[model samples]
Structures are given as structure tokens and as C-alpha cells.
Target: MTAFQPDLSSALAGSACLGAWAHDPASDRIALSPVLARLLAVPAEAATGTSLTLALAAVEAEDAVRVAGVLRAAGEDGRPFEAEFRTRPGPDGARWLRLMGRCGRDPATGAVTTQGLAFDLTEGRRPVGSDAQQAQRQVNRLADHAAAMKGLVAGLRNPPLARLVDEVAVEVGHELARHLRGGGRQVH
Candidate 1:
């Protein structure tokens, strides 16, 4: 039999970066991934106590109510949900996030908790297969670019340019990682 080979480009393009979260209402405790903490611009340790509030804080004011309602309904009925909403950052900022989650009641504690994955959708991209491959390749190219940019910035004494390069490197790295991890279908 021939060896099985997964299509890397298509697989990456269709993938998402999933950050898992668990929130217990009774104890008001929350557990979140570092990715989620970074996306929300909250301290990783701070998220354990009030994750829901911090997560909601990132939602755009107008979309907050709708997103909240969906989450609320899911908790009440024990159904899973997925929502893509904009975040309130700045006039020029794009802080879109998609949350897919479900609510469950513990058998022992009888406490209801909501748990699921969060995806950063700020780029609003469903990458074409070729684009995905190109992106992967681009990330490889960036390894060299990062080094060159660091040297150039040092020589030119340009802080802004260095920041821009750093941001791009981070964004590409994150996207590539997310695409590789977000492989499965929406959670049921």
C-alpha cells in the first residue's frame, strides 16, 4: 500500500489556533490558555479569577450583547455555540475573535461550566491552498528577515522600524501555528 500523506497546504489553510478555556460560575474560577490571555491583553495569571469578564471586555460594545446572549443560551440549554465578533480596541484596530464552546454540568459538584476554544479571526482569512503554502514559505523566509531586520535596526537606530518587523514576525508565527493546530471540526 502507498504511504498516506496529508496535504500540508490545505490542512494549514483550513486550520485554526484553538485556545481552550473552562469557566466555573459557582466558584467564579476560570482556566485559560496563554494564547487566550495574550489575545485579550490580560496577564496570564490574572485570567484565572475573572476570565469571562476579560474575554467579554475584548468584544466590541455593539456585539457584546449578542455574543453574551449566545453564550448565555448555551449555558442554560447545554448546547454548543460558535460566534465571530469584533473586539473593541481602536478605530483602526481589527480585533476579531471567534469563540466555539459548550456548557456542561459536573456530576459530582453539580456546577455548570462552559468550555471551548477561541480563535483569533482578526485577519478575516480563509486562506486559499496556494496562499497557505506561500504563507508557510514566507514564515521560513522571515527567519532570515528577522535577523536582518534586527541588524539593520541596530545600525540605523530606528526603533519604529524594529517594532514593525517584530510585529510582523510575531503575526506570521502565530498564524502559522494556529493554522496547524485548528484541524478538527467545530465542537459539538
Candidate 2:
């Protein structure tokens, strides 16, 4: 491996700091750039000779499990795939990667090589996963709100004014909590 700038001149145009891997379809041999090697924290020299299965093994266990299905589909059927995964970059911290690509016939040999771009998303990915979790929380909160309101309504029509007022207060508090969870929306 010479001191080359990863020769991504044509493949990585208009792309952010990223890496590319070109593989010989028949041999399953890969040529990877530093940007990608760094993204996965693989030693550039070592990565050149390494197998995809071996490289994927270094990925965090949880995410490794997450992408296994995608990898298998690509290997067996040349199926196209795009996925985002979290990988710890070292002692410094963690980062998320967005991989968009497919496995198709290699032009030279008609063998399928999985090729794609991988970029680190330090700040870009946090909100997406967070938003999904928050939305689920809000939905659960709303369900609880509906149940509490039903109980309050039943208590209210039952005759005792003092008990009715207490139930109303309880209902209002639950509704307020639900509103706060739902981005502070005023739900009538």
C-alpha cells in the first residue's frame, strides 16, 4: 500500500468526508480508502487484505447484529441496501454512519461487489433516533391521559360535588402532563 490519498477522485465527488471500497467481485478482495478505514477505525494497511466479514466483526455487537440481515441479502441475492448504524470510533466517543449502496455485478468480472459511501454523522443523527423515542413516549402518555380522563368523567357524574371537583382536578393534571409530553400542544 503506497502513500496514496485513497484515489477517490471520481467516486467521492460532492461527498462529505467519506470512504469508498471497490472490490474484485470474484475474489471478494476489497480496495478501501482511508476515509472509510478511519470511519471503521481499521488500519489502512490491514484493511486492504481483510475480508468484509472480518471487518464487520469489529463493529459493535449490537449494530453488527442489526446489519447482518442486510449483509446476507446483499451477498446471496445482490440485493440493494441502505442502513444507518452506530459504531464506537475508539476511546474518544461514538459516531453514527449512514451507508447507502448495493451489491451488483462488477463491470470487470460480472461478479457482485458491495460498494457504497460511508460518512460519519457526529451531530446529524442524534435528533432522528431521539425524535422517534420521544414520539413513542408521547403516544404512551396520551394513552394514559385518555384512561385517566375516562375515570374522571365517570367520577364527576356520580353526585358528590366534593368528589367531582377532586376528580376534575386529577383529570386536568393528567391532561397537562400529556400536553407537555406532546410538545406542549394544547389539546382540547
Q: For residues 1-188, what per-residue lDDT tens digits would candidate 1 score against the true structure?
A: 21487775555346555467776655545676786666666677776656466666766776877876777777788888787787666443657778888999989988899788887775544354676575665556566667666765777777888788888767656655655655333222
- Runs with alpha carbons beyond 4 Å of true place in candidate 1: 1-14, 27-30, 90-92, 126-188
For candidate 2, write residues 18-79 as lDDT tens digits: 76665444554555677666666667786675665555555777886766556556667776
What is each predicted model's overall lDDT from 0 to 1? 0.68, 0.62
- Over 4 Å off, model 2: 1-17, 22-30, 89-92, 126-182, 186-188
TM-score of each: 0.53, 0.54
TM-score between candidate 2 and the true structure: 0.54
Instruction: Identify the candidate with maximal TM-score.
Output: 2
Task: Give residue 11's error in model 1 in angstroms.
Answer: 6.9
* Model number with the top lDDT: 1
Pull out the clashing pairs in model 2.
none
Clashes per candidate, residues 3 or more apart or on different chains? 1, 0
